[model samples]
Target: MNDFEFHLDQFMLHCDAKNLSRKTLKSYEQTLRLFQFFLENECKVTEIKDVKSWHIKKYISHLRDRGKYTVTANENTKVYNHPDKRIDLGREISDTTIANYLRNIKVFFNYLFQSGDISENPVKGIPVIKPKRKQKELLDPMEIKRLLSAMDVTKFHEYRLWLGVRLILDTGCRVGELLELKPQDLDLKYNAMLVRNPKNNKQRYVYFSKRMSNDLKRWLKYRDRFSDSEYLFPTIRGTKQNVSNFEKTLKNIGDSVGISVTPHQLRNNFAKYYLLNGGDMASLSRILGHSSIDVTMKAYLDFTDDQIRQKYQRHSPLDNLKL
Candidate 1:
């Protein structure tokens, strides 16, 4: 087999072996196509062996040149830190999209080098340019209530629509983790849930109130009657539901109620309220299924501060005594 074909097969097989997601595979495919196109059109080369570092430099230059345009890289790489300095060539691009493209290109080139298609990988020296990660906004209690109330419980789809939001608010579970839940995973006697196959392949138990147990009992009763309710949170039509559809349902419920609520926000609210109501940091961490108490403390530090102040003001022994 030819070098080009061999490299392609090796890289694709590696991607499959790693169990990369479909979305990631698509991005890799696009990057490889772009690399081939650059070699063909930019360098005026017909063969893969003809590709060179000069060609990659030109690609970076092309990206930088786009930043000079009105509606280009500048829009993507907004100077969140400095408004005056707009030159990306001298510094770096803050656009996650551009960084991804560059990284993908480098990975493709590295794969070619490993497959014996190239003598050296030019991308080896180039650093992975990362962007500023934006802070996620947590949805407020009113916003969550609005979204939950807007769902029309009369319809099967709508009943589940609110249930998804409520479950997350009541129990701080990721959307994928929540959907991955099975009917038997819920432990009512313990007031806890076993999150199987969690992030990093770690299994953890999370606890909730007696109210959650009642809610689960009702949901389980309804679920057991259905022929296709093997999963804890089944689809409206009673089949396994995907996270995307569940997300869309949350967004739709928000639109109907005139409030904004996402799956992350729902979980955030639970953590937020849990901290607000005098919940211990370490215990809340265990209930949220967080690997570290540091994560729980950091995320809800403000809530803890408020809780401490409230308790001090309300239950201080000196308050009952005469001054």
Candidate 2:
């Protein structure tokens, strides 16, 4: 090709023709442009096909050195932050953003190398930097209880929306997994549901207590009022729903219930609470569809202490003897 822009345009065309989401295409384009700029200005290179891993590495490093950082948007901007201040305003990109741009850059090269546009895979050895995730903020069971009970279930809206709250607390599924459920995914007899397209496309079964089954039964009947929905929890419209649709409502419920919790908090709480009450990590991992038990353990290292203590209480021989 003539220039980096030419390859980028073709890459974008491929992405669109393959039906990639617009957001995904825009991200690919944005990061490629940054890469192009980096190549021409910093590395004195002009073509993406000619670029090597070292060139890409130096580009990311160059961006970092240039004080690249992304500001986080304030969640409650109208209440706590100035609208103008909410906009990111600096050279500092966030760890996540730096990672994304890097990831997209790698994809660009992989596309080039595989398409015979490049002789060697520049990104073959390049490692994506993973920023240590911030500690998970999880609510305690009582906190969740306070939040759920705080909801006036008699209110029609609250009752209808209760399915979202119940599923999170009971199964510990991600908001995406919870919202992605359909009529076909449920098994009321076994109190199980199949959660598909989880993180990394991992699919797993999540079970609920009998109470959850019963509550779901009630909702399944009334949920049609939301529109004769095929999805276990359909969007306001009959079409497929996005996770954003219900997150705000759940947050509001938590606020009303006197707990500072997100859907994620409830998920962590679900794992933590069950494991606290003699639940096994392996089973919990399966229920949550965690690819590894290590993930569940890391997320709830503190809860494992409780499990250990309970294990001794139940299995220790001395416990049955008179003191």
TM-score of each: 0.67, 0.72
Q: Write the per-residue lDDT of candidate 1 for residues 1-323, one digit (tens) a residue.
A: 54554565678789878777666777787656555655555567655566667777677766655442223222333556353464553444347767887888888788778877788777766777767654445566566667667788766677766666677778788888888788788888888888854344567877767887887788777666654667888875667788888888778767776776678766776876676666677888887777799987766554445556775676567885744
What is candidate 2's lDDT per residue for 1-323, written digit by digit as tens? 55787888888999888777656887788778767766776678886667887887887776676653332222343455443453454556667778998899888889888899889989998988897666555565577567778667776556646668878888888888777788889999898888885444558777888998988888877777667777777665666557665677777877775666677777887887787667888999888777799987876665445556775787567776855
| Each model's lDDT | 0.69, 0.74
Off by over 4 Å in 2: 5-30, 33-46, 50-55, 58-92, 124-126, 150-157, 198-203, 255-258, 294-323
Q: Give the worst 10-residue stretch by lDDT in candidate 1.
A: 68-77
Q: State each candidate's clash count.
A: 0, 9
- The positional error of residue 260 in candidate 2, measured at the CA in angstroms, is 3.5
RMSD of each: 8.6, 5.5
